[model samples]
Target chain A: MTAEIKWVFLYSLLTALATGLGALPFAFLRQVSTRGLALAESLAAGLMLGASFSLIAEGSHYGLTQTLTGGAFGGLLLLAGKRLLDGHDIQFGEIRGAGARRILLILAIMTLHSFSEGIAVGVSFGGGQKLATLITLAIAVHNIPEGLAISAVLRPQGASLLACAGWSIFSSLPQPLMAVPAFLFVETFQPVLPYGLGFAAGAMVLMVFLELLPEAYEKADSENVALWTTLALVAMVLFQTYL
Target chain B: MSSTPILSLLVAASVAALATTLGTIPLSFDLKAKRRALSAAYSVAAGIMIGAGYLLTLAGLESRPSACILGAVLGSTYSFWLRRVTGSKKFDDNDLESIPVEPKEVDRFLLQSSFHSAAEGAAIGAAAAVALPLGLFLAAALAVHNIGEGMVLTHRLYSPQATSSHPNAVPAPLLWPTSLPPAALVVVTKLPQIVLAMGTYFLIQVWPEFLPLALGFTAGALFFLTLTDLTPFAYGQGRREWVALLCSAAAALVVLGQSFFL
Candidate 1:
């Protein structure tokens, strides 16, 4: 196998193991209060804000008209997606007690989310090395919460720990699955590279506004949310300077 | 042994990694006060990102408008496809409230979020790895941004309840767990993404012909983020709409200024 393939295998294995092992912490923490949860949510909001600014803004430096046009296109696409999927539903995996339609809907939503993440990974790789590592790390950090969210949803449905683990693993399967292929033969797929990156960026931007930020507002006080957001920005600045 | 290229790449990668890690530190705090602090941080980071994109990516690829348009179209189309395939679910207050306290579930959430962040980091690293000085600068900026993201995410998972009870709490001392499984997971998953990102950079490094395309692709990603994510998030709530707009404008201006002055 090529050196690149070896790296891909290692990454995929590590990600799966980390995700599975990460789940163990919750068992010990037991119960977290609602107040605590809100605080955490706010923080997450801030971090996303910082990330969006630092990564996306930096991305724009490549070109003005082109970047702006691309951004506009991406925004419109997200809006379109929201409109199309507004009331639609689908399902996947093993269905417990929920109707087949509901299960399908859940699965579909999960797939959509995961696919966006996969695209992000693919795009980040376009940058190569350090940039890719940064993107991967950021995505991985964020995935922990996503895994928790998925587990919470599945737990009520009589899903076992192993099952939850499986789902969590499945949810992120697209990241490495996509990354490895993209990396191994980026030359062959050169034509679509820019578009793929753009798609991922657009999707991520949409996710932050449509999902993450709104959730932050719902859970935390306005002031607290604002503060966390600011901190997130500061953190970004500091990281840039120090790193 | 003129290893300037490799040396610079290492510098860029390390810097990117550190920035992302540092940015994520505040996220571990589970306090309401800390959350607000994190939000403010995000706004600033957003400013930096917007500025960087305009100054670096846009300036570098000014020759290729068509590629940029194409990139954007592809991005939006993909997002549309995903949405069509899966219905959107709005997260409620109750969902947030139940986050931190719940056992085992939090771990999964953290892992997923971290994974996402790592992917972003990898992209930044790759950009730096290929472009050298220009990419390095962007990577540095992105590293800072990723750190903020990490802080925000960490705070979300740790203190979900703090927001609901004290909407106006003062910023508190932020403390992150030194040995969380999620953190380790984030670092581990980042390894390959970084490598792939570097490989991409290598390709670009070898063939200067691809610079325009690379720049265009990066521009597309940034542009999509600014218009779709940052702008909307800034304007989402009626109260923060103006602030968001101002921030967005300021961010753009910073880049404009850099283009002319820097």
Candidate 2:
């Protein structure tokens, strides 16, 4: 059992690490154009949007009301967080003010999202190592795109791709942290799982609307923004659905 | 050993009414804070409503497309007229500090809420009469759904703007209980459907036809309300482009979620 638990933690960590790979594409680009940055943001929006609904759908297995109520609270939390952070002269390394706030907000949102994925990882391990591995691998693959999403928002703000990759992995650190406890107490985690999923979904949805989309629109035309958003959204949903 | 159809209908109607009433509890919370969070919350509510409306439309279309279309048109027209008569304009302010909403608007909003809830109740009663399981599922669904309706109602009708804008508007103490009356109307509207579906022999077949109409009307009203009123208000609260973008994403999310999972 201890061996199994160690494997669960390792596998979950691997998924978290996989996120950094999303920044590789950014490494290849010499300089991102304004339109390119906008498209990247749209892609991130689409991915988050797809993930939010998927989380809602998964959460519905426990109860729709539980999931939705949790979602509402999640929105409240984001709103409250924004209000609290507003007017503060925030600084992180070179990033400061609104840029720091934006990066920090998305990282916070994504990290919160990882908690649910961690729970999934932990809960799956309760089934067995095989189930755990499969779930971990899927999450790991998904995290790559999520990492790219982080880099997309971060790269435009002048963060190095390495830093983008680091932030991307950092956003997913919750998975391993959350997995062990959930695995240890699957029964206890069962009821509250939907709420966690819903909370993440709610926060991500609000972030996309309140933060990411507006920034994307600033750099490009509505048609371009909509086009990339729709395309990426459709792609992400398909990816998750099939996988 | 099995319960009668009438018994199930009564139980369903009661449960739905109770659920709706419970939903209004949030109205009791202190909404004194004037912030963009209120609008964000409203946008979130609109997203949920839009998802519900989309699902309802799909379900109605599955049964009767023509009826759904006709009901949608009527529902949209009803909403339009309600807004027009009340002279409700979009809240152009930065936050919930002050809304230009009038007292009559709240009344109209409540009227629409009752109408939608009544439709839901009728659907529950009709479904219950069809089969025990189907009825139970729908009743349970609507019971959950009405909570959201209750919240949306309180959020819009009892918003800080509604009270602050008009000094004579419904007070919190008096208006808090108003949530119950609309809930009670659910049972009232449900009783006839229960009687018609269970009491008369031939009316059971007829009741199914009304399902599409009811669902369509609810969906149409929700679509109109979310798009025209709620989404616009959300846009005015802050960045318009983001609201439009996220709103579309939300719609897509609902579409994908419903298609894949539900």
Report per-candidate DockQ. Answer: 0.02, 0.05
lDDT of 2 by residue, B24-79 (tens): 56444444432244455545555655565555555665677667656665665665
Query: Given the true complex, what DockQ would model 1 score?
Result: 0.02
lDDT of 1 by residue, A1-243 (tens): 477555554554444444444344344434445554545444444444444444444444444434434444554555565555555553335543322332233333444444434544555566766776676666566555445544544443445667666776776676666666666665654444333333334443444444444555565543344444444433433343233
Give a tens-digit lDDT track for model 1, residues B1-262: 2477666766666665555456444334444544444444455455555555444344333544444334433433343333233321121122222333233233444443333333344345435533455556655655655565555444444443544544422222122232454344345434443554466566556775655455434433443343333333333322232334334444544544443433
Which regions of candidate 2 are displaced past 4 Å?
B1-262
Give the per-residue Cα lDDT of candidate 1 at A125.
64
Task: Assign candidate 2 its CAPRI class.
Answer: incorrect
Q: What's the chain B TM-score of candidate 1? A: 0.63
Best by TM-score: 2
TM-score of candidate 2 on Cα atoms, chains taken together: 0.56
Best by lDDT: 2
